[model samples]
Target chain A: LDAEAMAAARERHLTLTKPPGSLGRVEEVGARLAGICGECPPPVPESPAVLVCAGDHGVLARGVSPWPSEVTAAMVANFLSGGAAVNALARTVGGRVSVLDVGVAGDLPDHPLLRSAKVRRGTNDLSRGAAMSREEAARAVLAGAHLAEELVESGGADLLATGDMGIGNTTAAAALISSFTGRPARETTGRGTGIDDATLALKTRVVEEALELHAPDPKDPLGTLAALGGLEHAALSGVVLAGAALGVPVVLDGVVSNSAALVARALAPDAVGYLFAGHRSAEPGASVALEALGLDPLLDLGMRLGEGTGALLAVPVVGGAARVLSEMATFSDAGIEG
Target chain B: LDAEAMAAARERHLTLTKPPGSLGRVEEVGARLAGICGECPPPVPESPAVLVCAGDHGVLARGVSPWPSEVTAAMVANFLSGGAAVNALARTVGGRVSVLDVGVAGDLPDHPLLRSAKVRRGTNDLSRGAAMSREEAARAVLAGAHLAEELVESGGADLLATGDMGIGNTTAAAALISSFTGRPARETTGRGTGIDDATLALKTRVVEEALELHAPDPKDPLGTLAALGGLEHAALSGVVLAGAALGVPVVLDGVVSNSAALVARALAPDAVGYLFAGHRSAEPGASVALEALGLDPLLDLGMRLGEGTGALLAVPVVGGAARVLSEMATFSDAGIEG
Candidate 1:
């Protein structure tokens, strides 16, 4: 991010039509975009693309989530058919959806939008041992970065959004957030897919056990991620890094994506500059991760659904923020007294 | 509002291939629209229109606002020329913008978008006496109602938003909110248009003095409106009533529109059901009025710009909420487990 460009955008906001600081978060997002692009009056993100990385977790063997691992690949098929909530919400904002099968337990059919790049069927249970080897984690991250680069360059996407679809992904997310933020498992764990009180208690204990089993150092971010049991997490974090390197903004969804962002931030501190917390999730883990990342979410609709649904809603908001800088007349242009 | 239709919409949301309650406030809004329209999966507000009521306040003589009254007329010109924040924002959502000159103090050039229906140039200074006669308040409100009706019927607007452009209007809004909500003037008054601490104190004092002089009963809503000095408030309240009568949702801008909503609620309690508090303003009085109206704002972006810009931004959210109900496939249709 360029400090000079951000300062210039802030100064330009005061000169625009509205009163100083009236646009609030929108103004801040505009300034941040300017800094990201190093351009005063940054280009409006006209085309936003969403990447839904689907993986299965072996932690489901621990009964972390009630749904079978098969649901992950099923949802991917639903996404391909444009029938899921993510598809409906993406259409609302003129966004294109692309699904990446990083590691789904079941097979998905071929489709134009589907990028089948499965590293493995699923991860090993994190509670017992490392989910995957460090080398495998690096491969998954590279796959995500390559796809994100393709989306921005060839797909004509100006904005990127991170999405995840794993049956027990939230359980993995809680563990990753607890490890990265150094917060207690109880604070980071939440009810994934509306679990009972007994299940929540069990989930929290599982996260605590995983952290204790592999007290991964936060400084070694990739190792921490590899210690965790989710291929999509590594992949989503890859998109964040790729977006920062490409100077395109990446909007984050709820808990799953936010946890991935923590990993992204750990790997590349500058990646946080290219991120937008699209909406605060109902999940407790999301708030902890967002706070650790120092991000103020643009929308707080109490949505916890992943599949990039929450972040997709914020695409127009980001576009509108840019429009305010580029479209609205200044005080001088309108001939109004300063 | 039909309770049965709302119940059907709520039930439908749970089956829309997402987890229950994951969509948050969008779910609530979709059901509300269903109730208002007596239809399951109510139509998306495809053509939302914003009606900006431009007026002037006689209370400007008492130093309530720093900006000149002429700025109101100039801004009306800005709106007509598509050079204001509201214009840029409305364009972002594919919404049409219409300006009604309910009571600007200066002459405005004829424009196709401008509906000249001035209810006197301004109002009398309210600190000393009534700003407008009871008859004028009713007329201004009627004008607002007529414009709202036209926007919906002829302009093909299914969603309505209230906007204001009077220089010293927030001072008048504070007084009205205090009167209708039964809150003290100091609690209701706020920093309208970024006033200094000294001016805020003076503005609070002005509201208190006006309330004390009239002691307008909340039961007589029109009389209370007459006792207040802003023409836009009456007209904006009229838009609220007309929207309710037309069975279309009305999105409110900020403190000014919120105060007008309070008046609309006082006149007809059912009108509150048709209103959407678009975004909470930075003004303190907005919270007090929203509490009185029992409306949850869709966005809390810390914006105080009151040209319907805040509400206009929420138009897509409202539309998307409806689309979720209308366009999304059910879990049964997608063959997902119930």
Candidate 2:
């Protein structure tokens, strides 16, 4: 983010018609875009690609989510078939969707939209052992970074959105959030896919046991990810870092993506500037993660579905912010006195 | 709202690829759209017109808003000349804009988009007496209804959005909200356009004084409009009613529009079904109005701009909700099992 470009954007905002600061966060969004792109009027993000990272969580063995782990592969197939909510939303916003099988338990069939980047079959049960070795976690993170680079640099995507499709992944996400934000497991855990109260209690207990066993350190994000994070979390974190490194904006989805963002921020604090929270999730951990990251979500539809549908809905809003700066006539340009 | 259409939409939601209630408010929005238009898959709101209602408030004598009263006419000119934030946002969302001179203190130059329906020079000082006579208030309300009818019936607009331009109108809005919601004036009053602590205190006092003077009845909406509502308020209330009578969706702007919505709801409880809150305003009164109306705003950019900009941005989201029903493939249609 360039201070000079931000100052220029603020100056331009003042010259636009209506009262100063009247546009509120919309004006701030434009300024942030300008600073990120180093221009008074940042280029509109024309090409947005949502990366849906699919992985299985070993914690499913403990009955965290009501749905079986096979649902992860099933949902990925839905994404490929363009029959999922994320696909519908992305199509509405003119965004492209790509699925990456980073660590699904079942081998996904070959598909044009599905990218093969499996780090392992699945992470170990966090309640019993480390989710992944540090090297495996780093490898998954690097694969995500590479995918993001390919999408933005070669795939002609100007914006990146994070999505996740893994059954029982919310348990891993809650564990990550609880470890990073120092919140209680019960406070961070939520029923993914609307589970019964007994399952929710079991999920919370599983997360508590994982955190106690791992004692993940906040300062070392990779170590924490290795201890408690799912493969999708590493990949999403990689996507965030890649967006920051490449100077592209990344819109994060619900609780799973937000948990990944915490790791990404710890790895590179500047990465926070490149990220936009797409929506507040119904999950309790999402608020804690967003507050810790100092990002305000653009929408809050009480959505808990984590296929990047919420973030996809926000792409137009992000584009509108830039358009206000790039396309709108200023007071002086229209010969109207302030 | 049509009960049959709403039920059909809910059934359609279940047939979609996600779990029940997973899409949260998005599904609710789709159901509401179907009910409003009386269809299983409601037509996308392609033709949206933002009615920017311009007025003057005699309450400016109380020194509520820091900006001069002339900004109303100046901003109306800005709107006509396509230099205002509302114009920029409407353009971004492919929505048309029309400025209504309901009660500007100064004469505005004639333009193709400007509609001259001035009720009076401005409303009388509420602290002194009724803002307008009961007949005058009724006339203003009728004018708004007529404009809305013209826009939706003949003008070919599928959606109607409300905007307002009046200095010190926030004070009037706070008073109306205080009267209806029974909250303290200080709790509802806020610094309009960023006022200092001294001005905020004075604005709160003005609202308190006006509320005491008017002793407005919650049940009598027209009489309340006569007592404390601005001309734009009456006109906007009329717009809400017209949208309901005609079964068109109406998107509301900030505090002023919210205050008018209160009156509209009081007059016609069914009118609430036709309204959508565009964004949550920074104004305290906005929350009260939205809560009383039971409408959740789509965006919360902390915007205080009252030119329909927030609502305009939300036009796409509204469109997307409908498109999800109209365009997306169902689970059975795509051969996916739910």
Candidate 3:
């Protein structure tokens, strides 16, 4: 955060025509944008992009999710074809969609919107062994960071949003949140993608078993990611870190992104400052992660879809914050009392 | 709510690209909008207008507020000059603003955005007697409803948002909420515009005393309004009722609007269907009023500003809901299966 810019933004807020602090969180959002951009009136994040990180979770074999793992590849194809919820949301919010096949069990064909950045075909089932080797996890993280940098610097995106399309990935997210937040698996686990009571219970058990098998260390983010994190999780964490490094805002989606945020925050505490929880997910672990990060989501529509739809919906609000700071007349400018 | 249009909207939602209910509250908003417009794929609420009802509270004489009653007229001037927070937000959200001087204590000059609809110089001090006569309250409400009708029918505004510019109106709102919900004054009262702890306590006591003196009935909404409601409150309630009668969506601002909504709902239960709680107010009374009306606020920014700022900010989200329904590809069109 840029202290000078933040101070300037706060000063500007007090001078605006409305009562001081009457805009509440909207005012804070503007100030945060200023700090991120190192300018009193930060540039509006007009070019928004939702980066959908596609991966496959090996935990699906443990009956953790009712949907088949092939749904990941299928959803990736849907995203590329602009036939998914994220695509609709992006269109609605005037944002672009980019899909990265970070780790899919099946080979995905090249497409215009798809970026082939596979770290591995899939992770090893955490209940059986570590999800991935530490080197592979680090490579995935680097790939995500690099992609975020490229999108912001070269692709002309001013804001990056996180999205995921991995079946049974919620199990990994729950495990990661449980490990990082020191919460029990049952507390962090939730029904993903409209699972029934039986599947939810099974998913909870799978998360508990995986946590026991991995015994992930919270102190070591890389070790934790290697032990239980999915390839997409590591990549999304990279996106957060890269957004922080590049000083652009990163809007996070549901539980998967929240889990990734926990890992990113652990690796670089300052990264959390650049991140925005777009909306509260219906999943239980998302709240835990957001609480840990001390982020208040912009929306709570009970949305749990992980294709960046929730985050995409929030893009206008983020833009509005910047617009208010940049365009609103000050009390003196409008010849009104403060 | 129109059952035929609502049923059609539900059908349309089931056929949309996303899974049933995946869009969560957003999907509900779309359906409600459809019901409001009496058609499937309801027209986008493109032309939004925020009606800011300006008034003075007679209770200000009781030392319930630190600010002078003249601030109400001054703020009305500021609003007309586009120096208020409401104007900035309206500009940001691409909405028009109209300020109604329903009950300003002082005389006002004419302005482009100002509508002179004075019911009285102001209401009588509520702790001493009824705020206004029963007929005056009804006339104020009719003025609001008539303004809403004219704005939508002739002014080309497709949506109406409620705003208010009244000092010490929060006290009247708290009293109204306490009367309607049967909540204690202390539970429903909050510091308005940065009141000190001592002022907040005094405000609560004033609310309790007024309620005790009037013993207003929730069933007799007009009588209650005459007893405890501000002139602006009566007008806002009229706006809500008019919106319902006209079948146009009305986005409500904060506690003052919520209090009026309670009265509107009491007058016509189905009127609640046309209303949207734009954001959760920082004021304590807002939650009680929303709960009584069974409405969920779209934003929770801890904002206590009452100049339609919160409701104005919500314009885009409401627009997005309609856009998703009308523009997004359905499952069949996108060649995807739910």
Candidate 4:
């Protein structure tokens, strides 16, 4: 990863057979990897792991979503049954999808995809109390990072991506973003699931009230995160830490993930380099969060439906970038009169 | 597939997990395959084959490209070296990339990726005469199809995507699109490798003139394709036919590919349903070609670099769709109170 290593990696990439610079961004990633790993062709992870964190938000009682709190548990049931879109996408990509019960109000039955790691059934409603104690928040973050680290250290995964399942979590994300960036609540809240104008306006007001009450300190990033973080956010931040520590790629999906990454970067600025922004979420906070983190989203489809869908879609792009670096032709080896 | 078989396949898809109608077009593809093959969880190909056809256009002699015809050979060198972006992507996706020399004018050195099956050194300039005689055209199409059939029936490839490597081939595609759609050449021509306004004007005029000379009969798509087809076009048409005969998937890449698919559909309309438009090309004619074939493009990224970059990006999407159908939960299994 040093200058000498990077230059050597670049030389190896330039020696591959193809037109110089024909593979574009893909070649750059390959060369960067070669330099970092100090190998001609670094092995792409044959096994990728996805960590899905589930939680409940106290803000659910505030009527931010049209769907009831029970929908979160219901969808979790769907995920456990291997019926969620994420399951299918993971299977298609030959990656394993595991669900962790970071926190949820309802009791979750034992099932294959479900990983019972609840921090507490749910965080305290931020409008009324500290969402979670700083100690509990740190535990949730460590839990996420630990799971990913276990997979990588066991040689069970080459890379990791974080997925989330929660109701009113968008409110949690908006609150976290507002706290972290010192942005107004209105700037960070949007129609989470096609909410009507009147409901959106009301939701914004509620967020604004919460922001006013919390008045979280931006200088203390983790403190702000813990004060307003959903259990899933903490877990995702952990996934990012694990990826960075293990020197593996971690794809961050949507708003909840973006917030987690913002916190992760606060903890370790170098961690941002290990992350790939899969796509821009329809959530208003996503852009602000990504901007704060300084990352460009790979896809933009006005998609708000989370459950790791956008991240899953961007998997190929990530894979493609790596592939280009590993396989593209250099100017000379291609045997052209260039 | 028979009516009963098709009905059973349809039943299988409707029963899979996630929402009943969430996956849209992917659901239809899954069902149709199930019906056609009469297998609920159809065995996916362990080895997917990508057939990249390389050819040269006589039109390049007219000074239409920023790079010389030699760049085609240079890129073929890249493909053989396993250094092309497509090569890397295919490796990442666990597939093999093969090159077919259908009609390059130059002699290529023996290499592993290159498969020599040239019908001629190159096609005749369409501006002066038909690109290939009808007999030669049929031979080329059948040759590509035979290779595809061999991959599935003998080489054990379950899925195949058609890619092309040829300079000046886009001009040939524009002429074919204009002839097939009865559209103006100006509307169909686009900058290849970001050509300047002056060169683009020349390319457009050349295509218009070629279309007038061919005066293709829309009712007879084969005749139209034969008049304007590059060697790769004829070969790609063959790939589509082979896929249809073998009942496998053939993902189409860009404009030249669109023209070939149009020709393939004319040969057998059922082929259209079997084909998936991988992505929309930045080339102006590609959309028209896609529309004429009545297919939906999965991704659009203003990519005109060709070499099947768009299709390579889409390999994961098709794989993901299949995974969703095979792995996701059915509503009955999730135990939700739906």
Q: How does each model score on TM-score?
A: 0.98, 0.92, 0.92, 0.84
Worst 10 residues of 4 chain B by lDDT: B16-25
Estimate, for each residue in B1-338, the C-alpha lDDT of model 3 and write its tens digit: 78898888888888875557878888889999999998888887778999999889899988887778877887787777776678767876678999888899988889988889999998899988999999989989998998899998995689999999888899999999999999999989998887889888888889999999999999999999999999999999999999999999999999999999999989999999999999999999999999989999998888888889888877767877887787766767754555
Candidate 4, residues A16-58: lDDT per residue as tens digits?
A: 5433444444455555555444455655656777788888888
Between 1 and 3, whose TM-score is larger?
A: 1
Candidate 2 lDDT = 0.88
A246: Cα error in model 1, Å: 0.5
Q: Across residues B232-331, which tens digit of lDDT does each residue of candidate 4 receive?
A: 9989999998887777877888888888888888788888767888778878899999999887887665555567777767667666666655676665
Candidates 2 and 4, the one with greater TM-score: 2
- Where does candidate 3 stray beyond 4 Å? A105-112, A330-338, B11-19, B106-111, B328-337
lDDT of 1 by residue, B1-338 (tens): 98999999999988887778878898999999998888998987878889999889888898877899989988888898898888888877888899999889999999998999998999899998999999999999999999999888885689998899999999999999999888999898988889899999999999999999999899999999999948899999999999999999899999999999989999999999998899898899999999888888888888898999889878777888888898877877777785
TM-score of chain B of each: 0.99, 0.98, 0.98, 0.93
- Between which residue pairs do clashes occur in model 3? none
Pairs in clash, predicted candidate 2: none
Name the runs in model 2 displaced over 4 angstroms.
Answer: A107-112, A133-135, A328-338, B327-338
Question: Which is better, 1 or 4, measured by TM-score?
Answer: 1
Count clashes in each candidate, considering only residues at least 3 apart in sequence or on different chains: 0, 0, 0, 11
Q: Per-prediction fnat values?
A: 0.64, 0.65, 0.44, 0.47
Positional deviation of A21 in candidate 2, in angstroms? Answer: 2.3
State each model's CA lDDT, in order: 0.89, 0.88, 0.88, 0.76
Model 1: residue A51 alpha-carbon error in angstroms: 1.4
Per residue, candidate 1 scores C-alpha lDDT tens digits across A1-338 of 98998999999999986678888888999999999989989988878999999899989999988788877877888899888878878877888999998999998888999998999999999999998889888888988898999989895689998898998899899999999999999998988778889999998998999999999899988898889849999999999999999999999999999999999898889899999999899899999999999998888998877999889988878888888888988889888996
Best by DockQ: 1
